[model samples]
Target chain A: MSDMHIDDFKHEALDHIHHHLKTYVSVFVALMALTVVTVLASYLKLSLTATIILALIIASIKGTLVACYFMHLISEKKTIYLVLILSVLFIAGLPLLTLLAKYDVPVN
Target chain B: MDIPYTVQPRPDTGLYNAKVGIWLFLASEVMLFGALFSTYILLRVGAIDWPEGVDVLNVPLGTLNTLVLITSSITMVMAWAGCVMKDFKRFRFFMGLTILLACVFLVVKSFEYGSKFSHHIYPKEGAFYAIYFTMTGLHAFHVICGIVVNAYLWGPGAKLWKKNPAQFTNRVEVAGLFWHFVDLVWIFLFPVLYLL
Candidate 1:
């Protein structure tokens, strides 16, 4: 009886992952669509600022999809998120450092 | 005594030791790439006549590599799923495909880089080539690292599966996370470098 229960549990777990296959396929399709859009946006002859914004926004979305699903961050624990938060904070600081060095020089 | 959380979740962290370790490693990777990205921005904004990246880069090739990496991500997850399902054959097939796709990406990338060098376009040519080579070359290094790790998992590391199935599967999952992170970096790099 216990063996039967273990078999069922394994089956259910595998089935859950099998269902995620569809999510993966759909995400792939969305990513491809976004890629096409990214290339097209480049040729749209928009303002430099607009183009940069659009490209980055699209890239951010793609990055999120890969991180959440492909990297399994969607179901990750609090500890992993904590680590990422720290990383994001430091990364955010990097640009600030550059900006400081570039334009924030104190008057002599 | 054996390792405390080799195959089991630590109580405080609610994750295996390796999972936490890889994530921490990935965190540092983010900062490394982030600094380079900031440099790219400063270089572009400060330069007088920035090169038209789209004109210089082969978009079709970059697109192909993006597709290839995305496909490998799916196969990688499927490989782990196969392990979960107790299907070693399926795992091997998908793992093999992931490694093959990684090799293809590197080959295509090298082709792109080689053509530039053959044209005598070195990183010293301009700020554009400097940032381009630095960013993509670093990314290519990550791809090489992924290939080495994945290759190990595919070869002798496969023995671990028979020794301890749970630990083996966890190792695959951790590796998948790294592989996916690599793909994530490319998703950003594709547009920022090539399209922008």
Candidate 2:
């Protein structure tokens, strides 16, 4: 039974690694496409809001690719994944919170 | 409980220990730079005048440095691959080239920084100069550290490349990952600080 469990685990791990490799390639290609679009967007005379929004979207995609592939978060254990998720949540929320606080004012 | 005579089976986690360790280290680094980037954004947004005239930065020089750094990344990866293939001669050659490329990058960066300093474009000039100097200064420091570390690994100091080639490959791979991260950060900074 113990030997069987070990074999099963090995198979599962290899499968996981293979699946992640495929996904990583796709994400990397997507990131390159987004980068090109972002550069093209800059040349056009888009409004400030539109430009900022597009840039942020592209940045998010790039960040996701790095976090998942280069950092190996996609293949990490559950505990590690939890830590990553918490960090992202804190990082993303802090900017929004700061922006809202800055714009808040007393109204008559 | 009586000890069992049967040999315990080792679990197959698939990931090697070094790979996992490198990823954990990278995660911490991400947080470190994340805070710096957040501060940059906050300051840029809160500024009233938006610190105009930063276009004084030499775009051609910056572009050249970008290419040099990117080429270094490629060479570093090639060095790692050479070690994996047990080609010590090629590994050393590529590592030497990587170090040379990194030095070229630093020389160009120093020229850029020197020109700014000669013009008295210190932090006291304005907020734009303040942010500009701080960011680039920090990046230059990282490049210096990377070069020093690469030299130690490829030089006679450690000599792990000769003793244990696999461990040497791991070291080179981790260093390559960090170097790539540095290049990635500059890719964003180049457009924002120079082109934009």
Candidate 3:
């Protein structure tokens, strides 16, 4: 009876691993498709502002996918999320402070 | 002494010790890369006439390198899954592929750098090349670190799988998280430095 139960548990673990593998492959495909879009968007010869916005958007999506799925952040615990969110807040602050300082320069 | 919470999750934190440690390290890395990105922005805005990345850098090579990194990321995650599934052969295969893809990225990147140098284009050339080499150089260094870690895990370090499979798997997951972070950085770097 115990042997049967152990076998069942092993099968269940394998199933879960297989599920995660499928998700990993799917994310890979999405990332490649986004890469193609990014290159094509560049070739569109859009204005600098438009190109920056579009490229950043695509990159953000790709980054999020890698973070959430590939890095397993989606299923991570509160402690990990806490650390990540804190760092993100700081990183977000960096560009804001940079831009503010850039524009606040003294007029010659 | 055997480490506490190496394989098992901590009661309060609900995560293994190394998991938390890697995330903390990655957070610091986020700040490191973030500052460099800010510098890039500052230089671009202050320049009177900044060259387009597509014009200055090899976009095709950059794009190819991006794909290579992405593929490596997938192999990395799959290797972690292999560990979870208790398939040592699968783990080794995917891990080996991840390292190979990383090498391909470095080779392509070296070619890009070599071409630039042949044309007398370098960090000393201007702000664009300066930030480009600084950011990508740092990133390539990280890639090399990833390769070293992964290769160790794939080769001799894998002996842990016999004595403690769970611990070995956790090690792979930790390494995979770092590898994925490297790939994530490239995802952003590709467009910012090459396309945009």
Candidate 4:
């Protein structure tokens, strides 16, 4: 940070400001691969919990690629990350709260 | 007054106000969908005779829609890149592809929903179908919203490019961010709703 001039930093940042079409194609292919994995995993005769976990893991990978590349989160600033982290924190809590529903009566 | 930070970054945040605004909006959207997904998990975990989703949903159709969304995501980014490269014609072409893909997605989704309704598989059929209708119906609403946003940017919004090119490009990028978020949600929803 100290060595490079402020102008240099600006130039370096510009390099990533425009992503190439090739990267988008690669990401698209990766997403398709993960989608195939998810569908194939669902076809496996594993226990329900195992299948769910596997599918979610694959989905998470696909989601990560979309968010990082297409959403441009990888090149985003700290402020945006702060907002996203907060959102993730709050959203993560919803699932925990959902577990509370287990104590309630079942509909079926 | 004309919008501030439409073409320049704010000193403090080091980002244009619109960029910050979109991220905040997306963050909130994450929670909105997250809450529904949590409810799905809670419901599925608690239900006794939870029907198998694969048996009920058409996996082939879901897979095809996944491809549609993935292709749209690529086209969407290409559109935004076209803006960055100062090629309005390329931007319009890629954007048109994006809109077309979105319409195809909606058409396929409509067919899926139609079959369910025709078979009398209403939300009242059972818990699985209820959640299916609610979650997919909500997602479909989002698709409509995306279509409207992209369509506007392609039509009247393109006029902005003439007077304020930088700001117009920024707007396209912001719209692409939202489109990608929509695709991100589908990436997860496809496997959960259709396969698992």
Writing each residue's lDDT as its tens digit, candidate 3 over B73-96 gives 999988888877778899999999
lDDT of 1 by residue, A1-108 (tens): 244433533454477887787888888888888988998889999998899999999999999998988787898899999999999999898888878887777889
Instruction: Give TM-scores of chain A for all candidates.
Output: 0.84, 0.59, 0.79, 0.72
Real contacts recovered, all predictions: 0.72, 0.05, 0.81, 0.72
lDDT per residue for candidate 3 within A1-108, as digits (tens), equals 234433432354477887787888899999999999999999999998999999999999999999999887888899999998999999999999877776797899
What TM-score number comes out for model 3? 0.94
Number of the top-ranking candidate, with DockQ as the measure: 3
Q: Estimate candidate 1's RMSD in Å.
A: 2.5
Which CAPRI quality tier does the interface of model 1 achieve?
Answer: medium
Show model 2 residue runs off by greater than 4 Å: A1-84, A103-108, B1-18, B52-54
* RMSD to the hidden true structure, all candidates: 2.5, 7.1, 2.9, 5.0
Lowest summed lDDT over 10 consecutive residues: which window, candidate 4 chain B? B161-170
User: How many Å off is the CA of A32 in candidate 3?
Assistant: 0.6
Model 2, docking class: incorrect
Clash-forming residue pairs, model 3: none
lDDT assessment of candidate 2: 0.65
Q: Model 4, residue B123: displacement in angstroms?
A: 0.9
**TM-score of each candidate structure, all chains considered together:** 0.94, 0.72, 0.94, 0.92
* Tens digit of per-residue lDDT, candidate 1, span B56-137: 9999999999989988988998888888887889999999999999999999999999999899999999999999999989
What are the per-residue Cα lDDT tens digits for candidate 2 across B1-196?
A: 9222112221443344555455566566666666666777877777886642224788678767766765676577666656655567877887899899989988998898889889887877877777778887788887888888788778873476555454566677677767767766665665566544
Q: Using DockQ as the measure, what is the rank order of every candidate, best first?
A: 3, 1, 4, 2
